[model samples]
Target: MRSSVKALREQGVWSVEFTEAQYDLLVRSMVTFLAIEKERFARVVTVGPRAEELDAIISGAERVHGGKAVIRTSLDDIHMIHSMLVFLPTLFTSEEDFVTRVGFFKENVAEVAAGLKRAIVRTAVDV
Candidate 1:
């Protein structure tokens, strides 16, 4: 399952097949990765202060400014992680234990396509 998650991660975890056990592993791995990322973000946002108060006072705003820049640079990753870890789980439906929809399409696209094949037929004229 770890390997599967790693594969999904390496390939970009837009979609993948997962059993209950694999889902658990994926969630754990994602949460762990996101935690590590959050921690790294926190660590990276800090600016070193000079030992002397004179220098420290002068550079304190630099730290805040740097943090703002870092936050702007990282907001997308943070939002993506947050959506995956927090908002995603709450959307579990009664029929489906999990959802595969993220951006454009469902993760279980093969199944979806198969189900809709007849309805989604192509005509002589192309788009």
Candidate 2:
């Protein structure tokens, strides 16, 4: 998953950019799909990126006066699993576009989730 994320990060600049609202909606949907997969599969999910990495990104964004970033890093470990089981099939695209979009959002979600995890960790560390 980490390797896939790294590849997406590299290829993302060339892909379509989704609006913030779209991104949020996609993430939320992906998360819900993940929950359903967990229930159906009856197994534990792993978070991909570490929380500390997510926190560092958010902290930097805050310093730059970025508005609230709603990327949910806490959900990374399960993003891929959920994506595979739920989101991918429903995208309704040609195999090429579906593959492209999946790779693109997978990375986007992972990066966001990693940042959120970092923020979560930092808050915990400070307390």
Candidate 3:
């Protein structure tokens, strides 16, 4: 799954240039990847003083997911999410630890997902 995500990222799958149908397919693929990793992310653990900060980040992401805020999706935002999903894990001892310590919070995963949703809505409207 990670390799597939990396391959998509390398291919610039999130670029704004994609046709609506193509973008929709890519988004579905991304959503699937996230779903597959959800259990792993939930198992991540954080220790030390930085843990609180990480918790706050997760809370913020939850709020975003809950529609407490509006996020404008940009290509760069999509790229950031891809980087978090693909590259960030390699920097830590484990994928779970990476997520616990900094993944959702640092990467603003919810906001980015919201932004992607907004982009999709915009595309639907445009169509």
Candidate 4:
């Protein structure tokens, strides 16, 4: 799963025919991943071409406390996610790529959840 997703990321700058459920999974995992990475490295992450947008996303994710709603993204959120992190599907050519991407997330959600938990733990300790 991760291999296919990584392959799609390798190509870059593309789209795929993703169903709503697939989009939800990808969006959820991507956002959660971004949120944790942002939290785990907030200071350095403050700088980048897409910093502001990514910051805004992480902020929202934090506000929701990185809940399921983070994955229930709008078109704008989808576009934003496309521009940041590992990026999205490889092409708009088929649903297969989309399914592969989403499957990658589904397969890795527990990992993302653990990372997110650690991130939250760090913040709580500091607070």
Candidate that would win on TM-score: 2
lDDT string, candidate 3, 1-127, tens digits: 1111111122333322332323333334334334443554332321222222322322232123322322223444544443433433344565466455542332333434444445555654554
lDDT digits (tens) for residues 1-127 of candidate 2: 2211111112222111233433443445454445444543332323233422322322222111222222222234324333333333454446555445444444444454454344444544554
For residue 76, what is the lDDT in candidate 1?
30
Clash pairs for candidate 1:
none
The models' CA-based lDDT, in order, is: 0.29, 0.36, 0.36, 0.38
Across 1-127, the per-residue lDDT of candidate 4 in tens digits comes to 1112110111222222233333355455455445444554442333334444544553343123223223333334434454433333322245554445455533343333333334334534554
TM-score for candidate 4: 0.27
Backbone collision tally, model 2: 11
RMSD of every prediction: 18.8, 12.1, 13.8, 16.6
Q: Comparing 1 and 3 by lDDT, which wins?
A: 3
> Please, what are the lDDT tens digits per residue for candidate 1 over residues 1-127?
1222111122221222233443343344344333443444432332112112212221221122222211111223322432333333334443244443322122332232232222122211221
Q: Rank the candidates by TM-score, best first.
A: 2, 3, 4, 1
Q: TM-score of the candidate numbered 1?
A: 0.22
**Colliding residue pairs in candidate 4:** 15-91, 15-92
Q: What is the lDDT of residue 24 in candidate 2?
A: 46
